[model samples]
Target: MTQPWKPDRGIRHAVIALGTCGVALVAAGAVLDSLWLLGLGTWCLIIAIGMELIYRP
Candidate 1:
């Protein structure tokens, strides 16, 4: 018999937190016109999306 998939809540929460931080950073970067912050935020967002997809339940 095959078992159903289960998500790791801790990882999920961390991913969410990362995504939120990425968004906040992106917004802050835009407001402050900071290229480095914007690049970092974009990188974080990409990693968050990759993690969510790879670790899906």
Candidate 2:
């Protein structure tokens, strides 16, 4: 039997959530003219990508 179709609860899930938030932050920054928000979002996305590359289950 198969269990589920979601990320395991922990590092991967957290990283994915961060990526999702990053997308939202980028959009909000664009609409609100906030450079800080854009930078934070970019960093979040970069971290997510790096984590995904390093983490393996």
Q: What is the lDDT of residue 24 in candidate 2?
A: 92
Candidate 2 lDDT over 1-57, as tens digits, reads 876764555877888898999999999999999999999999999988888777743
Taking the tens digit of each residue's C-alpha lDDT, what string does model 1 give over 1-48?
Answer: 854754577679879988998999999999999999999899889989
TM-score of each: 0.82, 0.77
lDDT of each: 0.88, 0.86
Off by over 4 Å in 1: 1-7
Q: What global local distance difference test value does model 1 have? A: 0.88
- How close to the true structure is residue 1 of candidate 1, measured as C-alpha lDDT? 80
